[model samples]
Target: MTLLYEPERFKDESRTKRSKRQLLLTKAEEIFRTQGIASTSMIDIAKIAGVERRTLYNYYNNKEEMAIDIQIEYLRNYGATVEFKINHDLDYTKQLESYCDTYIKRFLNNKNYIIFITQFDYHFRHFSMDDNLDRYHKIMKDRNMTNNPAMEIIALICKQKELNVDDQLIRKFFFTLHHCILGVAQRVIFRESVFIEEQDYSSEDIQILIPILVNGIVSTLPSYQK
Candidate 1:
């Protein structure tokens, strides 16, 4: 007699494995934020995650790989949320506002992630030469071409308004918007003295800042002026 296998059992096992992996990644992220990546060992992550050292290695080969995975996961989740907000807003200007508002709120709410992103260049250097790291970065860059919310917003404005502006100019406009958001987010995250004298900035401050930069961009667009 031949034995048979159930597909449902295999599906359940796959889901269980994914849950375990996500749990481990969440625990490791907390440790990375509190202890800093350089000082954190795989042992530390396993201890904090309340899992065996062997089990941790079963999911991630090393701390560097795990950290990169965590960062990529964060980006994927964040991008999806922003895309949802932009997609729902039918008006072009409303979509732009949603983009700015969502980004500001998300960054402000996730201070740890903001801190990680602000120091990403330094942290990434540790694994810069790794093939996996380089390959993942290339893949993400390619993926961003269609999935990027800011780029989609610009394209929508140009298409909906029938603007005759050069493509390069529209790209430059998006770059400016990107820089403005990142610059403010870094300043708010670090509490830079030049941007804010206080130890913190409120959501209200960010709400005010978004419109100013976004409107400035709109004012410069040929479609807006006409």
Candidate 2:
């Protein structure tokens, strides 16, 4: 029995679909980054993508759907980078700092993406965003993407520091840290001078406070001796 190769026509069609989808997302992200998501429409995206309205619809039902997919794509890249940065050789504090550094570097490297996220948070709300996020998480789970990078990093910390605490306790701590870092990064990108001009503190200095806070928390952890 011989295995039959897929026909060239089918291969070409698949490639064309992928190419068009990529073009659609590229154009859509550009519009989203410049014009707020609420201001941008399917027609605008289609026009920028150089595709018919119906063709754009063939890929996504609405801008919300495309936005969710684009977010998932960015997060997947971030997750991969986080996974790569996890070093078992480092001690607990260093590992935690590495995680924070990853976020700071990635956010500073792509201010546009950080700006887009700020816009997205301001514009999207209620049921539609919730439903889309649920769908996005499902896709991530199906693809075996890391569901919680912070959880993974914290677990490593527990191992390296010889800390024995309840899983729930560590989870709560790490999640809080995760959001705290994220919120700080977004603020840094959106209002670079707010900290300095108004608060008399440099944004960089404010960011440094997070690692110091993290170190303080780790020091106080019941199992952490140093």
| Whole-model Cα lDDT of every candidate shown, in order | 0.67, 0.68
For model 1, how does the per-residue alpha-carbon lDDT over 111-148 read when each residue is reduced to its tens digit?
A: 67766655554567763455558856865666544456
On lDDT, the candidate that comes out on top is 2
Q: What 10-residue stretch in candidate 2 is worst by lDDT?
A: 1-10
- Tell me how many residue pairs clash in candidate 2: 0
Candidate 1 Cα misplacement greater than 4 A, ranges: 1-13, 84-95, 126-128, 144-163, 190-200, 222-226
Which 10 consecutive positions of candidate 1 have the poorest summed lDDT? 1-10
How does each model score on TM-score? 0.71, 0.73
Residues 1-226, model 2: lDDT tens digits: 1112232323655766766776788788888877888899899999988889998998788998778777766665553235435566767576677667765676666666676777677767632455677877676566542445656666666666677767677667766676676777677767776767787764455458557857866776765433
